[model samples]
Target: MKGWKNPILLVLGIGVSNIGNWIYFVAINLLVLKLTGSAAAIAGLFIIRPLAILFTNTWAGSVIDRVNKRRLMVYIDILRGILIAIIPFFNSIVPIYIIMFLTNIAGAFFGPTSETYITKLVPPEKRKRFNSIFSFATSGAMLVGPSVSGVLIMYGSINTSIYINAVTFFFCALAIFFLPDVDEKLSSEKVRERITMKTIAEDWKAVISFGKTATGFMIIFLMFQFITLISFSLDSQEVTFIQQVIGLSEKNYGLLVSLTGAGYVAGSLAVSALANRLSIRMLLGMGSFLSVTGYLMFYLASPQTIPLAVVGFIIIGFFSPFSFTGYATFFQNNVPVDLMGRFSSSFAFFQAMVQILLTLLLGYIAEVVTLQTVTVAFSAIGLLLAAALMSLIFLQSKKALFILEAENNLTEEG
Candidate 1:
């Protein structure tokens, strides 16, 4: 199989799988809220899935590298489909929690393993384009997925959305059939050497802590994750702010979220064009700066102004892909390919762990403090962290732009 075709198929397949997640999440959150009328329960459900992912991602990654990534993804998708199909019939909170737990198990394996396959299939030179295309595919699905899920719940039923999620997962599994074996020709000896969790963890530790550059990158990446979680967790508050100030309905929340996704699509397009010209360090730094401004705008919006919030979301979407894609590409470039799955999984685990903590923390703040106050405070904290991380990137590298120069040198040598 040619390179582009494989990545394209992978993106579509993964996007299809993500739609299931999107549907399940929308249905569950809305249903739980309708049933219990409790924010804490809603938050609990959101937090539990990521917490499960945090604990399992490293182990999942280890398994992925040693086993067949394609098969693992296929089985994971199928299992998740069955789990979703089972969820709607059982209305008890206990059963719902159990099904959600199972979904998290599948998510932990599927996401990192698929990312590992992408790292292998997509060359460094083509990552920007590939990520842009992939981001657009997933984000586009996300844009539609929630609205469709909402419609299914509003018109048909919550159970209908669950059924749709199951079908989507099955289709996702079928799409996996098109994926080539990315680790196709590994020798028996090498496979045997990599079988243990300890071996993979050790490998991951070495790469992430390899030097100041690697460590610094990881720190900054962690901050990036923190900021993203804080921002997303504010979704409800954002809608509240709009409602209180401008008298918009809760429905506009979806439109604003779609705007954010649209911003991501726009950013993805630009990153595809400009990433090769910019260093990863430069891209991340600028992305962080834009995010700070965007969040600030959202927080400071006046009572009569809702468009400002929309603009802020648009800016976030536009710049977020640049930072995210740049970071992922940088990790791929710096880390050894053999350890890619482990390193990616470990990195993802830490990010998820932080997000889980922050979700609870931020939820508390939103509850105890005013949402406006919470939004401003966290947005400021996120902005400050972004600036600091950007400054450190330049300081540590001691070069204004390293990746572009490095790539140019490589090109000249070639």
Candidate 2:
């Protein structure tokens, strides 16, 4: 029971976790389209949250390592819920943007802290299983949330959907209360003990001092983020294309997005089962290949063949979290426990930066070109980048082999 309790709590949290978020996503986009009717404004709104995440993540991570992570999550949940609840009450776009920004700020803390907390609770050997379960729960929430919101919107309007989303957040906050206490090492004391500008400088020096592998990993993480942002930023436009060009009904289009969630569930299960037998690097490469292929198909393939598009999107769905899990595992395995929070935060920050750039770039491209062409170009670039990265990783591993052997020899001697 003790072993099961944490996962259950985490899943419950995931259950309602994205409810408000997805609702806001669909509703707000519709709202933006209805209001100003500007494609660029819609794109800006789509990209802004990630941009917000990019700016706050590093500072949030640094703070998380120094504070209680569980508490951070709880507070973040409450704050976000409150902000979401306020959305329906406002008629002006200005307040909506403000709330969105605030929600993104809270999100920066909520996501990384949740990861840090989970890492602390789940043992390394079972990380794959834990991650799988967590993914499933979030996927479930995402699956159900939008469906529920759609029904609510049918009965009432966008405002009613926002209200329902707020209810989901309220429940999420309650679920957070059930999470058990988690112990985390605070880095502040260590910094305080050596409190000096020179000491801070030395610590920064140590971070990059580890040489190219560490630095290179961070860079790869950023690249992967860019690819993901490119994929995600096109989601709204894809739905539009399906409805406008492909002549699909809204119900059918929703099903396509839902398939992506289903793919995520399947992919998470596969990764969890194979984590022991498979090398993380192989999975990482495979997942990247899948994403690049999936997006390329969507961009270039003829929408006249609806079945092909469905299959292509399922592939995208399948690989979505496969690549993310690789990134998560990389960070978990490499980062020291004490610096997990800060490092996770820094990773999130880098991710946010990638998102911002992708959003802006995609936004600009959408102005001149079709969304399909943009997706194809973005995906092709991702695939090419992934291939290059795999080659670099192979070379890095060979070089590091001798150093690893030497270290092993020293340990044996002692």
Clashes of each: 2, 0
Which RMSD values do the candidates have, in order? 3.6, 4.9
Relative to the true structure, candidate 1 reaches a TM of: 0.85
lDDT of 2 by residue, 1-414 (tens): 457777677767766667667776778787767777778878778666777877676456556655676777878888887888887777677788888888888887877778778778776655555655666666666777677767777887987777766776777777877777675344556434533456444444444453244666566665666666667666546876677656789989878887878887787777767666655566566777786687667656565788777887889878766666666665555566556665666666666676666766886887798766776777778778877755554466644321111121131100
TM-score of each candidate structure, all chains considered together? 0.85, 0.80
Question: Residue 395 deviation, candidate 1, in Å?
Answer: 5.8
Kindly give the stretch of ten consecutive residues in candidate 1 with the minimal lDDT sum: 405-414
Colliding residue pairs in candidate 2: none
